[model samples]
Target: MPHFTTTDGTELYYTDQGEGQPVLLSHGWPLSSDAWQVEVKLLADNGYRAIAHDRRGHGRSAKTYTGNDMDTYAKDLAELVKHLDLTNLVVIGHSTGGGEVVRYAAQHGVGRVAKVITVGAVPPQMVKTDSNPDGLPIEVFDGIRAGVLKDASQFYRDLTEAFFGANRDGSNVSQGAKDDFWRQGMLVNLAAAYDCIKAFSETDFTEDLKSLDVPIFLAHGDDDQIVPIGAAAIRSAELVKDGTLKVYPGAPHGIHGDYQSELGKDILAFISK
Candidate 1:
C-alpha cells in the first residue's frame, strides 16, 4: 500500500498505476480510493496513469478524528500532488471527492491540474439556504448524522441501496456493488465519517466553482438519489467557467459502477480533446 504523510501527520494510502498523463481519483464519502477501481484500470489500460487515494480517514488511510472538513481535505490533496510532483494532472472526483477536487484547484491553483472531472459529485452546495433554495434541506443531513450515530453498520448497509439506486424500480445495480459499498463504508472511522457528512453536505463550493478556469467535465446521473442532479451536477456545470456537462439519464449516484463504460469513454475523450 503506497502512502504519504500529510503536513498534519496523517498517513493517507493511495494507488498509482500505468503511465501517461496522470489522472488523480478522489472518491466519495465513507468509501475510499477503491471506489475508483474500475476507472483506474480503464485509464491504465488506455495509456493514462490513474492514481486514487484513500482519504485521510477512509479505506487503508489512518483513521483521524480531526481535520475531516473540506479545507483540510483540499490541503491533504495538495500535499498528495506535491508529494508526487505531478503536473498536467487530470483530477476526477466522485460525490464528496468532487467537493475536494473543486476546492483543491480553487484554493491551490491549477498549476498542476490539466483537467477536472466529477461523477455524481456533490458541489455548488448541497444544503438549502437563502441564496441556494434548490439545495437539500438541513434536516436531510441531520437525518444522516443521526443514522451514523445510532448504528453506523446498519446505516451503511441501508445507504448502499440508495447509493447505487438498488432500491429503484427495474434497477440493474449488482449485489456486488452494494456489498462493496457497504464493505468500504464499514472500514471508515466512525468519527471521520461522521464529520465528513457535514463537509460534503454543508460546505459551499459556489465561490470555488466560480473561480475555476480550467476545463471541467461534470457527469451526473439524472436519477441520482443521494445527490440530486438538479442541485449538484447541473448547477455546478452552470457555475464553472469552462465546463462540459454530461447527464446520464436514468443513471444513479453510483455511475462509476453501473455506467463505467460510457463514463470511461467520456473521460478519455475529454482528456484527448
Candidate 2:
C-alpha cells in the first residue's frame, strides 16, 4: 500500500487512481479510507483522479499516542496534498473528515484545493457553547469516550446501526456493511481512538468555514442519528459564503450507502460545475 510520512513522522496510507482534476477524499472519525471506496471508484471512472487517505491511528496509518487532534490531522493532510503536487483539487470530507478539510484550508490557506464538499460533516462546531445552543452537549461526547474506553469493540458493534441508521427494520444497508464498519473501527489503535473523541467533538470549525473563498457543497441526511442534520449540515450550510446545502429527506447518516446513486449523480454534477 502507498503511504506518506506526516510532519510528526507517522506513516499515513493513501490510494490514488485515474487521472484529471484530482478529487481527494477524507473519511470520518474511527473510519478509514475504505469508507470512500464507492466514491473513489465513481470519480475515477468518470475521468477524475481519486485520492483517499487513512487518518493517523485509523486504517493502515500509524497508531501514535500523540497528535490525534484536529490541528495535527489537518497538518497531516496538508503535507500529503503538497507532497502529491495536486492542484485545483476538489476535496471531499465525510463526517469528522469534513472538519479536517476545512481546518486545513483555513489554517494552511487552502494549499491547492479549489472546491470542497462535506458529507454528513461535523463543522461550525458539534459541541454546544453559549453561542451555539443547538449543538450537541459535551455529555454526549463524554458518553462516547466512556463507551470506547470501556469496551471499544462492543461499542463499535453497537454503534454500527446508530452510526448509519441501519437499525431500521427496512433499512437498505446490508449486514456486511455494518460488519465492515466494525472491522475498521476495531483495527484502529485504542489509545488514538479514545483521544480523537475530544478532537472531533470539541474543535470549532466556524472560523474555518468563514475563511473559505471556494465553493462548498454540504450534503446531509435529515434523519441522521449520529450527527443530526439540523445541528450539523443545516447549520454548516448557513456559515459558508458559497455553500449549497442538499438535504436527503428521511435519509440517515450513511447517505452514501443507501443513496449512492443520487449522491454519485449530484457529486459528478457539482464537480463538473
Candidate 3:
C-alpha cells in the first residue's frame, strides 16, 4: 500500500518488492499495478527489485479529471522513478504502458535504465494519419470512447475477447483472467478512462522510439486483435536503435499474461545480457 504524491498533487500507489537491479512495470489502459502481478513476482523471485504503479485516476490513484494524456502519463512515471531513486532499471510496459516507457525513455535519456521490454505495446502510432497509413482509424478510438461512456462494464467485457485473442480462435486464457481484466477497467475513473482512449490512440511515439538508444524488446502476439503486430510491434521494433521483435503465434494483446513463464525468462535473459 505504499503511495507517493506526484507534482500535480495526485497520490499514486505503487508496490516495490525484493532486492537487486530494479525491474519496473507500467500497466495497460484502464488497468493498474495489479496487472503486473505475475511479472512482479517473477522478477522478484529472479533476484530483482520489481515495482509497479497505478497510473493517475486508475486503481488506488487519485481520480482526477485532468492530465489523462500521454505526456502526463510519462511524467508521472518519471516522478515515480525519481522518487524511488532507482537505478540500473529494466522497465517494461504492456499495451498503452509500452508507449509510456517509450516516452519516458525519450524524455529521460535512458540515464538510469539498462534495457526495456514492451508486451503487446502501442507505439509509433495507433490511430491512422497521413504519415501512419497503416494505423487504425480515429473513428475506432471514438467508438471506444462512445462505448465506454455508454456501458463501461459491457465494453470492458466485450474488449476482453479481443484483448486476450478469444475472438479469433481458442484463447489460451482463463475465465478468471478475463473477469479480472473487466473489473480493472471498471475501477478506472470514468472521465480518465474516456480521455485515455484519445491519449493512447493519438499520441505519436515515432520520434520517441527513434531516440531510444537502449535495447528494446518488443514481445507481441501475432494473433493479437487489439493491437495488431503489423501496425504496432512490427513498426515499433524498426524505430528503436537496438530493438528486437518477438512474436508469439496465436497469442493475444495481453501476451505476457498467458505466456508469463516464457516472457519472464526472455526478459531476464535480455536484461542479464
lDDT string, candidate 1, 87-200, tens digits:
998999999999999999888847888888988989999999999899999999999999999999999889988887888898787788788888999999999999999999
Model 3, residue 140: C-alpha shift (Å): 0.9
Q: Evaluate all candidate structures by whole-model CA lDDT and list the values in order.
A: 0.91, 0.87, 0.88
Deviating ranges (above 4 Å) for candidate 2: 109-111
Instruction: Indicate the worst ten consecutive residues by lDDT in candidate 3.
Output: 252-261
Candidate order by decreasing lDDT: 1, 3, 2
Better of 1 and 3 by TM-score: 1
Superior by lDDT: candidate 1 or candidate 2: 1
Question: Could you tell me every candidate's TM-score relative to the true structure?
Answer: 0.98, 0.97, 0.97
Q: Tell me the TM-score of model 2.
A: 0.97
Error of 3 at 29 (Å): 1.1
Off by over 4 Å in 3: 256-258
In candidate 2, the residue pairs with backbone N, CA or C atoms under 3 Å apart (3 or more residues apart, or in different chains) clash, namely: none
Best by lDDT: 1
